[model samples]
Target: MSGTLALVPAAPGKRLGAAVLDWLAPVAILTVLLSFGFAGITSTRSAGLIIYDTSLLALLGSIGAGLALVYAFAVATVEGRSGNTIGNRLMGIRSADKDGYAPGLGAVFLRGIVTGAGILLAVLASVLVAVFKWFDAAPLILGPLLLLGTAWAAVVVVSSAWDRNGKLRGWHDRAAKTLVFDVVNGRNPVATGGIEGPYSFAPLDLPPVQHVASPVASRTPVVPGPVASETPVEPLPPAAHAVHLDTAAHPETAAHPDDAMDRTQVRAGVRQDAPEAVLRITLDDGRDFRLERTVLIGRNPAPAAGESQAQLLPVPDPGRTISKTHLHLLTDGTGLWVTDRHSTNGSAVTTPDGMRTALQPGVPAYVSPGTTVHFGDRTFNVGHA
Candidate 1:
């Protein structure tokens, strides 16, 4: 599980939507074929029984059927290689095997066989009418078959709704050992970022700001006055104490008068020049960065409000593996927090002990030193500088 990212299951609606789009070409072909076949049948109602052998309508129907066959093969080939079809891309979703890769030709063909059973049933009936039956299959039989086939196909599309494993696999998906994922909200195995359009983005969840009311009513004003000769001062803060020499408080230091520094100056210096801890980001691409302020890192990262002047680390990726604004990294004295910028392939953090957790888009998560952060195909190790 070195770089594994869990895929979120696609919704039933999205699955149905993709199926509808996938079915379009085949459906159109079938519709044209049936119409031509039916026309051929009606025309030869009073003609000789061998009319189909020379009928123009029968010839057109045969051509349409051939197109349908070709369409299926084309779709299977594309999906086998990319795990996406025309509809899957538009819906911002895809089908993949357990390792989140294209399931290959065998699985894709198997899936097509299972999911297309109903559609092919209607096509077969049309072929029988156009060829053997000489377009003589009754409308009563054809109508009901077509209707049943349509309904069955639709059922197959949304069958994942009834899946037992949290509705993650449809019947065809299970048969092919593939899984459908909501790429609009999760990692896209193919790329790190892109609005695979026709699908809405998930709503951004910003951290809620909690406002604490100041106790103004109970506060008292201090008057300007001369201090008593032996005025009692407030105890020094831990940081101030660490930076100062208080001989009066620690009599043992009185022997070294030369070591005495002005306590007030020391306290003031600590307050003004407190050191902050920053991070060193070491990329797998052999780039090392140690920036003090907020940073945006990606292929072509740009800053946002308040960070308009922030550091931009343009990753050297000719393949565009990372998003335009893949990650937002901020360092305070205490630690570092990273935010995923809604990249398509998503991002994740891996602990020193090898615990991997996916990062939610726009959500900040604290990372410890010696851990690795991954975005797209690139990975970077975080460490204290």
Candidate 2:
């Protein structure tokens, strides 16, 4: 990768705002139900007092309580499965685990229970007080406690403002073992790595690792020559001129005649047999690759079933901005086709004429030799090698 995929912590203000939004739907539902129920109360004031439709209020309140639980469950499920609730999406933030993945249903549910304990308990208290007439005076004791818990829940969510870790992890986050992420301005983890490092991938029928060698290795076998092969050898493509070259000026001559010829063949195979590549791709990190036919480019890519002929081009991306199999690059003698591999950050190409177009996922777009293809935090220029 050329630059870093910097992760920005979700700000305290944003988290608190999201929390409020996350709870808004259920709160609004319960409030509306309770308000309508209370408004329907009938009264007889002749005895200097009023009599209310207690049974009807209790029924509506109980219904509201049930609906609240359902709403809570729905919100938690959405957040757990996708790492975003309506509120989190609006705040441009999401909750994730340490490795930057969505915390599962259990964690997200536990977090909701802990963070929303106050309001939930208050609702339960009301339900209990209404369900049992014997607890008619229960509000005298429950009211203060419920109010205090509500204030405390607010404090717990806002406590992230004082978090020293800088990720705004509050008590609820700790209980859930989750961290909130800034998605709008930071790296978004939609796909895990399949090349290397700690990541899981679905079973893909991939070929052996033979293709990981240099591009030239496919057409011409490359023997692993020692680093000491710095001894100058004549750049002869054929053996007709190899025998007449200087024997003393080159180190391979000190050996037997056959050994000299063998070293010459090894040197020629190692450095001189590279085929003329149709497109030379220079990655942002300064490493270049010679694209001949089909090549899979990603953080760690492999040739799946139909792609047996393609080469695996592994890109070192610690931040995981690039997906496991990010893009598919296929080149003819004079044409190039780039297909985005359902990547998270998406891919694009800027032509030599300065026009930029975003590539749709799984669709191959034809680009000229001067076009530069950008995938995630990295880019490569397409040219003749």
Candidate 3:
């Protein structure tokens, strides 16, 4: 871990919410695509004997529009919820302001717009190029839009990779002054800290106030009383013998200093600071694991070429290279999930049959986010950064 301090903008495990939202996006897109495809096919069939080429083009355009809407919704929702879109999730990417937070809807919308514009421009450019090729004359004017779209896409990608956090600062996060925590361990640091030590107060005595007399009054000394005949004072009785106290007399007091310390401080300290384990997931091979930090949830090793703020961390101690031992983090458009990337350990899952059932390595298990993941002697969890 780098010694440089990584400011924790928000409590840890915030990205899990956005991950859930991202997971839902693909399902939503799939629904939209299938519906649109079916509808387009039906409409074209109903208008049979018409210009087949134009009809096909119209259907293609409709599909393109549907795709654009999916992109817009996916990006907008993720940006709104967490400051990045589904593309960011799938690509292990994110976008945020200089300071991380959930960027406002406006920033999300603006990012969506920028993304949409780029796609639109790309499509337009491709069409223009096709036209120019067909005409064999002066190239179409849409070439510039194509170039602009390409440039915009490149810029966004680069900005994300190069930014302080692995994020593309969109209008929403920027306007809202929020940033994104790209890789989250899914455990709440505040909760962790609370489990460790919460703010508390105790009472202690303060010094008493002082008093003074008037200088004149103090200056005048009183005359001593007339001397009286001195009588020999009788010696006091022999000092009382030391008394032993019974245990019952001091039930509240401890028998030893260490015991006192343990009662007063050790017990209180345990109540103050202690490590908390969140969730435990069992793999197919009867091996149970705990969540940890600095984990890679996505399969991809890199972001787009121009992704500016995209941060990359090398896999530390790729342990136990089992047959089905790879792992990936995935967002189900609502929450985050840690999944086995088809490792040879057989990705065992604890089944209701009270036995470990081997699942496909690529399958996912709902390991708690921000939770420390413990695997054999190794542990993975997110910390500051």
Q: Candidate order by lDDT, highest to lowest?
A: 2, 1, 3
Clash count list over all predictions: 1, 0, 67
Model 1 worst lDDT run, 10 consecutive residues: 194-203
Candidates 2 and 3 compared by TM-score, better number: 2
lDDT of 3 by residue, 171-210 (tens): 3235445444433422111112111111111112323323
Pick the TM-score winner: 2
Q: For model 3, what is the error of residue 326's alpha carbon versus the real structure, in angstroms, after optimal superposition? A: 39
Report how far residue 2 has shifted in candidate 2, in Å.
Answer: 22
lDDT of 1 by residue, 1-385 (tens): 1123434678899988888898787777768766765664433343544433436556776787788779878888888767789999888888776545566779988877787777678767766765565344457667888788787767877899998888878888888888778888776655432322111221234233333332332357454444344534557788766645574678765556533332222222234665677677777855567766688998799887778878898875433457788999987745678999977568999999999999999899998788899887779988765
The local lDDT score (0 to 100) that residue 56 gets in candidate 2 is 66
**Candidate topping lDDT:** 2
- Prediction 1 TM-score vs. true: 0.47
Off by over 4 Å in 3: 1-5, 8-53, 84-87, 90-99, 122-144, 160-178, 184-385
